[model samples]
Target: MPRKAAQVSEADKHAAEGGAVAVDRALFLLRAFRLGDTALTLAELAQRSGLYKSTLLRLLASLEHARLVVRHADGRYGLGPEVARLHAVYAASFSLETAVMPVLRQLVQDTRESAAFHVEQGEHRLCLYRVDSPQPVRDHARAGDLLPRNRGAGGRVLRAFAGARGQLYDTIRREGVATLVGDRVPDIAGVSAPVFGPGGELRGALTLTCPASRYRPDFRTDVLRAARALTETLGGSFPFDD
Candidate 1:
């Protein structure tokens, strides 16, 4: 007997034909630049993006004209000034961190523990904002770091509010918080609670982390209070309070 044909959804069919090929290829070329590779030769771009040299050159011309990519004096191409301008504008307009940083710093002062705001990114979570503990020895996770989203208190809290079905998540959802000790990092304790947006959707997680030695049973009260304040500030209602 012959093997059955694979199924193709109508959405996939529409996506395959509706998008612009040139625009997609140009974006592929731009995304080929990673965190550390500041500049790339034409050959390097071709190799990394798996595009032919001729096709890449054609795409690069348009990109360079739009200032989306630029060539240096050394004949290597990198992201252009437009990207930096776009980033600056985005940072200025998106003031979530600015508004939340004061709250995070206040939490750190109150609890003397590192505080952070985390947002899920696929299978990982990104630290969007962080305030370190005042202690001489403290945990050292920084903004933009990608960490596993299935471990740590912050991850569990986000996962729970995102509707992942499990006993652990169920308990977290019910309690309005999650706690982890020696889970994501060795000898570290963390407590996290959900932050929500105006329409009550999960926005991010507010987490407090410190050495396991500093883990106090009453710390949950502070964490929960901070989460509630942040939720209200963002025009979201605190489910636990309701």
Candidate 2:
């Protein structure tokens, strides 16, 4: 006989059925947009969301009516300004700075370089917390800015450590850290390492930044130390090569 499906509790079944199925499916479609994908064609959205075109039409109609999604002049669909407004509200209300800013501050004190924590936001990375170096000459980046993921050390570190595989990511997986020089800007350099959760999942990246010419041998080492410390504090372990 075929195996029977596991039984669900009465409470669980009630909770699962409490919400409208249409709402869940619509939300799934919205989540298909990742960092770097500012706009998507209808066909692309259908493929990424695993929904049929006819079904997408119905869903997109509802979403568009609510200003949750917009169709541009070029016929591509993108998130509407409503999404930005919601994100702004979320950013204003939710922050981990109280918990992690002190750690970033210490990293700055140790390396005398700007220290930051980054989190993946779709195809981009967001600087969630940052502490600038006291030196008059320092690199510039603001918290909450969405930065290109392929350009900076923190972005690459987030990708490599979070399971995107490649030659560079393979090396980062083994070493637990990443370094970059003039990758994003001609005069800025960075060292980055992964911070993980207690379950060994990626939490974010801890990065140190300084002028390309001023980056010293110890800068990378200090970033590694700070990353490890932060990971441990969050109940996670920094993986190292065997």
Candidate 3:
């Protein structure tokens, strides 16, 4: 089943109790721009993020100053040059595996599970890179593993965060994070979050995979933290608390 957006938000809010709030709201504003339009008026930006006009203006000004957003002559705003530069930095920084290898390594080291990166191409999420677990008995996923968008944890996370469909997209539009348990494989549980490119397009996803038995009561929190850390390290952002 396509997991309901309301249920996802409720669960996420309950899990984000002790994380970075400012970073969350800032990323929320960025994600809000993905709502049907590539550019937005200040009023539209404020409305989408549920922030006061004054607050949204201030945030926009800050982003503009940092070159993460660019204001048009007509008072509309779109993604800025700095985002392009950041994207270039990202592209030039590493090969696919090298780009996310640190995070994958960390995930495997910490959870003793498998970790991978997947990108959306047409109707499928293609595994582009992966890091194996140190344990001899770890679950394995290789490069080029193509799964449907609704099949597994990585797919669900990418789908929810991408906000591709209409109303379903709007509901999770401001929260750029997602999780799934057994949606893909019955006995395998995993979590994933979106990775954006310079143009704010869905470039791919970062996922941590583990056996269902290893998913403790606090597994969601652990995954969320790992996702947030990876985002920060990559100079990427998400619309939810770390």
Scored by lDDT, the top model is 1
Model 1: which ten-residue window has the lowest total lDDT?
Answer: 7-16
TM-score of 1: 0.61
Question: lDDT of each prediction vs. the true structure?
Answer: 0.86, 0.82, 0.68
Model 2 residue runs over 4 Å out of place are 1-95
Candidate number with the higher lDDT (1 or 3): 1
Each model's backbone clash number: 0, 5, 0
Tens-digit lDDT track for model 3 on 1-242?
Answer: 53343333321343346866555556677766653576888877766666656656777778888998888988899988987798688677666455577777877777777888887878998888888767776567787777778777678767776655755344444554455567777777776666654345566777777777776545555556666665655555545665
Q: How accurate is candidate 1 locally (lDDT)?
A: 0.86
What TM-score goes with each of the models?
0.61, 0.59, 0.56
Over 122-142, each residue of candidate 1 has an lDDT whose tens digit, in order, gives 999999999999897778999
Residue 242, model 2: lDDT of 17
Which of candidates 1 and 2 reaches a greater TM-score?
1
Provide the clash count, candidate 2: 5
- Candidate 2, residues 127-163, lDDT tens digits: the string is 9899999998998898888988877889999889767
For candidate 3, what is the TM-score? 0.56
